[model samples]
Target: MKTDDAVSALGALANEHRLAVFRLLVQAGPEGRAAGVIAEKLDLPASSLSFHLAHLTRAGLILQRRESRSLIYSADFVAMNDLVGFLTENCCGGASCAPAAQAASKKRRAS
Candidate 1:
């Protein structure tokens, strides 16, 4: 991804509500969730959730679709992967940093 695109994605995720919404959508996978369901699960007002969803959608981090009467939202996994790849492309001087990062992540989870 380009630098500006990465920055935009990061900026979108910088907010608490937006980050929560994005993470929830990621966990929900490609099938996604309805707007009402997301609002209920996140305990957010419909208006507030709509604002965050719009921000994410504008950032190209998430996608929205109409399913009958409900609006469904899902993470854009390609954009997500591209952002991650961009961030980690030169990590630790490009010496296969993932193994160490994964080991540290596992250790932290085990704690």
Candidate 2:
């Protein structure tokens, strides 16, 4: 992704509501959740959720599909991976990065 795309994605997630919404969609998996379900789960008004969803869609952080009368939203894993990659492209000079430690920790924990 370009710098501007990453920046826009980060900007969209910078808000508490948008971040929460995105995380919820991630948890929801590829099947996604309907707009009404999101609003109800987040305790957000329909109008507010709509605005947040629009921002997420525009940022390429989420995908929306029309299923019958409902609008389903899901996390765009590719985009998410890109954002993570862009953020950590050169972490700690690429050697002392936390991802290395994190990977080791996961291996140790699993063993």
Candidate 3:
């Protein structure tokens, strides 16, 4: 993704509610969740949730679709991965750092 796109996605996730919504959608996976379910799970008012969802949608970080009466929302994994790739493209100088970081992550997870 371009830097501007990554910046927009980062800005969208910068808010607490938006970040929570994005993470929740990511956990939900590509199958996604209904708007009502998201509001209930996040304990957010419909209006508040709608606002945050709109922001995320505009940022291209999430996608929304209509399923009968409910609106389903899912994280845009390609965009998310792109943003992560952009952020870590030069991590610790380059490719060599990734193996060490992966090892550390694996060790932490094992513990």
Q: Which 10 consecutive positions of candidate 3 have the poorest summed lDDT?
A: 90-99
The global C-alpha lDDT for each of the candidates, from Candidate 1 onward, is: 0.96, 0.94, 0.95
Which tens-of-lDDT digit does each residue in 18-104 have in candidate 2?
Answer: 999999999999999999999999999999999999999999999999998888999999999999999988878757767778999
Strongest candidate by lDDT: 1
Q: Give the runs in model 2 whose Cα sits over 4 Å from its true position.
A: 98-111
Query: For all candidates, what are the clash counts?
Result: 0, 0, 0
For residues 15-73, what per-residue lDDT tens digits would candidate 3 score against the true structure? 99999999999999999999999999999999999999999999999999999988999
In model 1, pairs of residues that clash are none
- lDDT for each residue of candidate 1 in 1-111, tens digit (9 for 90 to 100): 999999999999999999999999999999999999999999999999999999999999999999898899999999999999999888898578778989999999999
Residue 84, candidate 3: how far off, in angstroms? 0.6
User: Which residue pairs does candidate 3 place in steric collision?
Assistant: none
TM-scores, one per candidate: 0.89, 0.86, 0.86
Candidate 1 shows a clash count of 0
